[model samples]
Target: MTPPDLAQRLAVRERPPGRPVMKQRWSRLLFLHWRVDPDLLRPLLPPGLHLDLHEGAAWLGVVPFRMERVRPVLLPAVPGLSWFLELNVRIYCHDDHGRPGVWFLSLDCNQPVAVELARNLFLLPYQHARMRYGGELAATRYHCMRHGEEAEAVYEYGPAPSAEVRNAEPGSLEFFLLERYLLFSQGRGGKLYSGQVNHTPYPWVPADCGKWSTLPVKWDGLPEPQGAPESALWVDHVDVHIFPLRRLE
Candidate 1:
């Protein structure tokens, strides 16, 4: 879902002779997305997909997913909440030639708090952690942040937007946006988990949210499948994160 033209579009298109070009730059936030098949997930989705939700956290743990949006856009929106947020989750797979993999990326319009946190806490030298295979994405439960791990954070998804998503202090979060997505199913629990990555951007620079970042996500649950029963039954929800960082401007 990485749209190459995004950054280019952010550059000012028209400006007088030597005037400062005002571009619509991102607010130094990272995002993640996932798309699943309804048919495949129907049999797998536990009856209790919604168990406990952390209101203080962000985004609803289970909702709808949109398929049409690009990668960067879907970074903050809650999964399975809308057509714009849902997408086919892709995993990094290497071909015989050792190339990139396939996966999905959601848009960020609904998630405001998590997006803000990422902008504030997603610090420099981006970090990554892999479980080979672990966790349940279909079932809505509080994600384990793994105590003692500063880098590990708990993620939740749902139908509504986060409680506190406004940019309380503008220009607080800044960094390079090195975003990546990986999808995998837990071999033990048959739970699907998608890995979303973000690194510090171009060292770091503080920027205001009003002019730099994205609009808060818009939540809309999935519509009834129009294609076929198989298609409708296979889709499960997704797991995502908005990774942001801080650095000197």
Candidate 2:
């Protein structure tokens, strides 16, 4: 399938009008992506989404980040319930309307309440995991292991260099990976749904990695990632507003 037009994709950045249902901050994110054949990902998607490709290659990402101050729109953040660590194995896809978004294979978080809420309300594949984060700004370490499973990943990363910090050029691979504003998921009773989140374009920087592993992807039923990632990026922070999920009729 032809990739969505770059200009059209980039044009959909405006926040959908209305009060958002949720608010949160995603910080210290490490994005690791690998290029794969589109055919390998087709069957895994739900009924209404088409695998989104860039330059004819499908991309899968493993993102580990700190999730903070997550709460419903009008509610105050509750201590233990509001913050946690998250690791997701995701792929790029576009819905029937040609709106590109993420399709999560699994979202593992340290908070069980958040896992249950996401699984039941958003129809996402969320799992409870034991997770931790430490180290300093220049170098950070992340680790997670899903309950009752061998799925886990451990890695440390830091910024690439001063020269490598820049915005993603429009239509570039970096833009394709980091600019997504929508997410698609399969809801209860096999219904397909989409949710929107708005955030400023990521202040992306090339990143260097140490002691990385692809166990999360393997746990999602895909083959182990081969070789080094085609892209590794770090975004220090992005505050996000999440709209309510809507059924795709």
Q: Write the per-residue lDDT of candidate 2 for residues 1-249, one digit (tens) a residue.
A: 445687668866789988899999999989999998888899999788899988888999999999999999999889998889999999999877778889999998999999999998888999889998999977899999988776568989977757456778888999999998888888667889888999899998887787677988887879988998989999989999999888897
CA-lDDT, candidates in order: 0.23, 0.88
Residue-wise C-alpha lDDT for candidate 1, range 114-170, written one tens digit per residue: 334323333111112211112233322222112123332223322122222222121
Q: Lowest-scoring 10 consecutive residues by lDDT in candidate 2?
A: 1-10
Q: Give candidate 1 regions above 4 Å deviation.
A: 1-102, 116-226, 233-249
Which candidate ranks first by TM-score, i.e. highest?
2
RMSD of each: 20.9, 1.4
Clashes by residue pair, model 2 = none
Q: Which candidate is the best by lDDT?
A: 2
- Any runs in candidate 2 off by more than 4 Å, and if so which? none
lDDT of 2 at 163: 41
